[model samples]
Target: METILFFIIVGIISTIFGKSKRTQGQSPKKPIKVSGMEDIRTLFKELKNEVSLPAAPIKSEQKVEVLQKSNRTLEQEYNQVRKESESSRKALAASRLQREKMKEQTIEVSKDECEPSISMEPNAQTLVNGIIWAEILGEPRSKKPYFPKRG
Candidate 1:
């Protein structure tokens, strides 16, 4: 708003001076002098300085090439990470299979160990018969009761 006011004031002053100068019979080729000459000059100088200053710098080709290289490296890293995860998954599956096989072997060994022996010893029957006969006879009448051992 202030810049617009300055331009309007300068324009009004220049027009009034221009009309007065025309009445003086002065040469029309000469530049018209106004009371606000210094302000206008300063405004033009500031505008020239702003125009001379560079705007945003343009991106060079080298910067774009560097970004492309970094993108490729990132892609390689992503593929490596994927491969590592897949290998670890396979290793876990193999270990699980091995654990299951170990469990099956352990179960088989335990079953074998738990089975009772089927072979009989010759004295097992004789010992059983003697215990039965002795219980039937009650207490022996004599201290030395003879009992024959049979094969």
Candidate 2:
């Protein structure tokens, strides 16, 4: 509550001060200009005038020779890299093809390895006999035929 009252009092005082500053006829404040900017630019221009670095001697024929040699070397390196990249791409493609072929071969082998589990159709008598093992064993016998019978 004290903080609220304090803020309200401050707001009223600030509003009065702001209105006085805004409404009272007063002369405009002059803009402050930074000094030394022109001097710095004059110094820079003088330096640019004083310093005369002659261009490095570049004979037209030598320039052509260096450029030609560098171009040839760059072209050769580019060709080598392109050749290597091409070979790597071919190798990757071949490896992927081999991977696909191996997968297909594995599927084919698995299919060949798997055989049919039973004769075409189990007879009615065989099916009934298979289930009767539970009654014969007497102690809730379960899937005894499914468990291979001992000789």
Candidate 3:
């Protein structure tokens, strides 16, 4: 382990010294040449003239046509969405009315069934009362008294 560590330290030192020697022995490089102010001014003038040429008018006309087409499509989409929402609203109202009618019918049916029970004859009422008591007491029907068979 000690031998391996010694070789690693030696290798790092040799690389560091080698890079410093190579940089110190090299000559400095010359500065790069650049264009003067007149050349820059002429280039800027050419660019400005190209930007202000006939192609600008054609681009503006095309932009206008594109904007009109997009506006028409947006208007059509808005009208379609409005129609769909109106239809959904009508459907919702119809379902609400149907639910209310169903509730009224159920109420009427329950009331009719209750009226018959209230107006039942004495013998039938007594038999019903006995059956209800037997159910409450958990009595089996086989142990109950037999009734006359109905025609």
Candidate with the greatest lDDT versus the true structure: 1
Total clashes in model 1, counting residue pairs 3 or more apart in sequence or in different chains: 0
Give each model a TM-score. Answer: 0.41, 0.44, 0.43
- lDDT, model 3: 0.85
By lDDT, the better pick of 2 and 3 is: 3
Instruction: List the pairs of residues colliding in candidate 2.
Output: none
The ten-residue window of minimal lDDT in model 2 covers 25-34
Best-to-worst ranking by TM-score = 2, 3, 1
Off by over 4 Å in 3: 1-58, 117-151
Report the number of backbone clashes for model 3.
0
Tens-place lDDT per residue, model 3, 6-41, is 999999999999889878875346443366567888
> Which digits, one per residue and each the tens of the lDDT, describe model 1 over residues 15-84?
9998998889977787877857988999999999888875665478867998999999999999999999
lDDT of 2 at 66: 100
Give the alpha-carbon lDDT of every model.
Answer: 0.88, 0.84, 0.85
> What is candidate 3's CA lDDT for residue 144?
75
lDDT value, residue 82 of candidate 3: 100
Predicted structure 1, TM vs. truth: 0.41
Q: For model 1, what is the error of residue 150's alpha carbon versus the real structure, in angstroms, after optimal superposition?
A: 42
